[model samples]
Target: MKLEPVIGLEIHVQLKTKSKMFCGCSNRGEFEAPNATICPVCTGQPGVLPVINKEAIKMGVLASLALNCKINEHSKFDRKHYFYPDLPKGYQISQFDLPVGEKGFLEIDVPTKEGIRTARVGITRLHMEEDAAKNTHSDDKTATLVDYNRGGTPLAEIVSEPDIKSPQEAKIFLQELRKIMRYLGVSDADMEKGQLRCDANISMREYVEGAAPDENWAIQLNPKTEIKNINSFRAVERALEYEIARQTKHWEETGSPNTVQATRGWDDTKGVTTEQRTKEGSSDYRYFPEPDLPPMELVEIRDKQKEMLPELPRARKYRFMDQYGFSMADAEILTDDPYKAEYTERALSELVSWLLSLPEIEGTETEIWDNYGEKMAKLYSGWFINKLGGIMAQNAIDIRILKITPENFAEFITLVYENKISGPNALKLLELMIGAGGDPSQLLDEHDLGAMKEDKDEMDKIIEKVINEHQVAVSDYKAGKQTAIMFLIGQVMKESKGKANPETAKEMLIEKLEK
Candidate 1:
């Protein structure tokens, strides 16, 4: 029978705030000691209370807005009861019935086995939660030590419906979500750094042949197993694929025995998942309101956040096309990286005003990458993203980090446009000037790489020497050989130590040979 897979994602996004969710402890990217950043409140000490971080709530709201979610005016936190070594309080403070955001949808275009498929992935809810402590298990697990430093770190959990029909679709949705978060600067979404985590609840369904039964065999969905701790994107894809097959095999083997609803651990090294324990439901945790913390009140910060909000990806793309005469393709490439796009806007400077005034320039700035003026547009775009970007990453460096400012680059472009410098020569000079910050005018003063004027008396002498030295090539030129000119040009460059104006050398040679 043909099979279909049903999938949903429960993604946890770590808020990039300076402190913990309910405490003032620092959340360092990397740390040196165990429980160094933890305090009485976050550690769940008796008689202590949690104070919600205002910034964390605002960050969550901004992400919710970006995802097209409805912000819940009133919401409360509930304790998710569980027992593990990492949990100091035997439960995690998380939202259950009412979350911070709800009823959102994000459209994603994913590729299936057949072709490109667009699906509206429904979001059930987005809630705020505190992270669990880190457990280090290795050669040095003396006394089962735990690092509470990461505990109470604010995390936004986005829950999606089981609209995904395959593992590939789930992965695509994840990647799209990651890119959106990065664009908004809301979170780094770096899975490797434990910034983002996801748990999937997948089941299989029939094609609904004949009629939809009260409950088909497939609809029973064998015990929705929870696969745990997938760290990488590829790992997410692999774990889901493994789980679906494992569960399907279990059902097919023993006449579809009723499988247990249990937790499973993913052994990434072995590429197999093993059952951990029975998965807990809502009542298992004994959730209730915390007396220490008040209901989170979102102060109307629209005025401030709206101002802090930079140009979003789509708006930036439109500006690139409407304002800069960039083709849609160019605009897309330019807007793909937020920092690079910001840099491009800075580089264009007042040229943006000129482009805005002209009708012809209006069509130039589009997000479509149709190769419209592909070469020239790409030159500037690539340099901003690729060349200069590496330099800026070290210590808040700028485009002038390469020693060639936008004005200097513009001046160099002017020289090439005026034909004062040849195209090939200008590129060569740019590479040097960008690194050594050398003067373009003085570049060939001692080098002799430019064209020699015929009006000069010294030009006649150099021409005489070149003609006498390259007799074989001279004979070939006179005999109607076209390549002979290139051969003689190489010779001139060699003898002049790359300091001869190739154009003048060619013209002088041709004139002298004709006589």
Candidate 2:
């Protein structure tokens, strides 16, 4: 019998707040020495009261809004009773019934055999809680140590419904969620640094055999095995994929009746999951509302957080397509990050200003900009997203800290547009500008990087010489081989030491070769 896989995810994102959730300790514990950033409240010292961090709450609410969740007006923390070496309090302060947000949905695009398909995943809830401390195991297998520095860090635990149908979908869901968090400045969501964590619940059910023709069919689900400690997106997808195949094989071998629901941990290096222990139900936690903190009233800050929310990736994507006429792929790349998108827009605005100030103008500024804007936007998008993006990735550069100002970038694009520099030379100039700050024009002059022989008279001489030397290509062109003209243009550019403008060279080559 064929079976279908069911999967859901619980994601914990550490908020990028200044302090911990319930204590004054620094939340920036990723780089801190083990246990150095902890305080009495975080370490669970008796008689020390835990105070909630307001910034954490604000970030949680912002994340909820970004996820399209409904904000709960009154939400409070509960004590989750558990025993672990890392939990100094013997329990975690978390939300049980009334979480910060609920009843939300996230849409993801997945690739299939046919094409790209859009699916909506239901978000069950988004709750706030404190993170557990870090546990480290010595390589010698002699000791296990606990570091409380990560404890009390604020986390927004987002639970998604079992709507993801495949491992690919699960990966996309996490990627989109991470992108949203990064856009909101809520969290870095870097899995490598342990800022983002995920637990996946996966199960398989036999495809239903018979149902009424018009009735919606529902299959009975098998007991789910929850996989834990999946750090990265690739791990999440790989673990789930492995679990699905393993569970399916188990069902085939022993039947579903003998399969037991359990908790498992991914051995990333081993490429398999190992059983951790039996899965615990809600009652095992014995959750109780914390009497120390009162129910939070979020009405006052809800509107303020909404006002602070910037245009998210999805919305900005459509706007980029509508306003700039960018393709979906191009828009997606340009708007992947908030800062990159902002930089693109800023440079585009500066570019339009430069275009409007040009000497030739037969119409209103709006009309003029409209006529040339799409072409210019395409040019800017290509250079920024492809050329500059590659350079940044190669050099481990962050746009936020990059030396090239958007204004300078706009000037660089203007140079390319005006043919003051060839494409090859423009790339070289961009590299120099990124390494050291200077006016693009001044750099062009200082480095002698201007286009070579743009004057038709000089270009004609170069093209004539190329045509004379490349007799076979000239004969091919005269014999109606249109593509042969490119060969002549290549020779002209090579002779000019790559300073020759390609478009001008091509035109000159055509003029001389046709004759």
Candidate 3:
């Protein structure tokens, strides 16, 4: 019998706020000394009362709305009792029955062999909670150290339903979710820094070929193995894939699915999931409503957060495609980072305005945009995403600190579009501008890199020199070897020291060769 993997994810996002969730201690303690941000409330001293972070609550509401979750008007904290070194109070303050949001869905674009398809994954809940302290174990396995600096940090736990069918879908879902968080200014969602973490619950079920699972699929689901220690989205995908294969092999060997639910840890270096412990049910935590903290009234909070919502990634992506004529792939890359997206829009706006003001270009604003918007957009994206992006990567420059302003970038792109400078000279001018910002037109003149096309006499002299120097290629072109003209054009460009425009040189070479 063939088996299909059923998967769910538990994502914990560290909220970007001023202080810890229930205390006034600093929240920026990840890079600080151990226990530097700890206080009585966060470290669980005797008789310390917990106060909720209003900013954290506001961010939670914003994220919930972005995820299309229904916010609970009445929600309160609960005490989750579990004994661990990381838990100083012996219980964690989290939401139980009354979470901040629930019954939400996130749409992910899944790539298939044929094409891309949208898949909606159901969200079970997004609850507010406090993070545990950091734990460091000795290499000898004889001692363990706990750092309370990260303790009591605000966290939003997002639990997804078992709607994910494959590992690739799970990875895409996480990436989209992270983009939403970053767009909302809720969290950085950097997986390597532990700002965003994931745990996967996966199980294998026997299924018929070419048939969808029915409502009774849950009843038929074999006991799931909860895989933890998934530090990154790639790890989440790899762990789920490994667990599915392991469970499928067990089913084959034992003639039945594994009956016991368990927990496993992913060893990224080894590319394997090692058994950690048996999974615990909800009752094991002994959850109860906290007595100190009062229940929240969210009607006012929801309204305020809704007003503060910015344009999300998906909407921005569609707008880029419809308005700028950018392809889906290019739009996705452009909108992935909010800062980068804003920069692109501003630069494009400048370019469009400049294009419309040119005296030689004939047409109304709408007609001009319709005629040249796509062509200009393609040129801009190629230079921005491919050329400039590669240069930034090489020099370790973030878009935030980029020396080239959007206006300057727009000017540079216009230079390329108008062919004011040759392609090679344009690249050199761009690198110069990126290092020490300046106007593209002025820089072109300052560097003596203007295209030779405007100098018709000089271009004619260079073309004539190339035809005379490459007699064999000239003879080849005259004798019906039309491809030899490309060689002649290369000689013209080289003879002109990369100042000659290739198109003009090709036209001049063909004109002279035909004569």
TM-score for all predictions?
0.71, 0.91, 0.94
lDDT of 2: 0.87
Evaluation by TM-score, superior candidate among 1 and 3: 3
Q: Is 2 or 3 the stronger prediction by lDDT?
A: 3
If the candidates were sorted by their TM-score against the true structure, best first, what order would they fall in?
3, 2, 1
Write model 1 residue lDDT over 41-66, tens digit each, in one string.
88889988788888888878777776
lDDT of candidate model 3 versus the reference: 0.91
TM-score of 2: 0.91
**Cα deviation of 488, candidate 2, in Å:** 5.4
The list of candidate 3 runs beyond 4 A from truth reads: 209-219, 362-364, 464-491, 510-515
- The local distance difference test score of each candidate is 0.71, 0.87, 0.91
Please list the residue runs of candidate 2 whose C-alpha ends up more than 4 Å from where it truly belongs after superposition: 112-116, 208-220, 359-370, 464-490, 507-515
Higher-scoring candidate on TM-score, 1 or 2:
2
lDDT digits (tens) for residues 279-394 of candidate 3? 99999999999999999999999999989999999899999999889998999999999999999999999988998899988898778888899999899999999999999999
Order by lDDT, highest first: 3, 2, 1
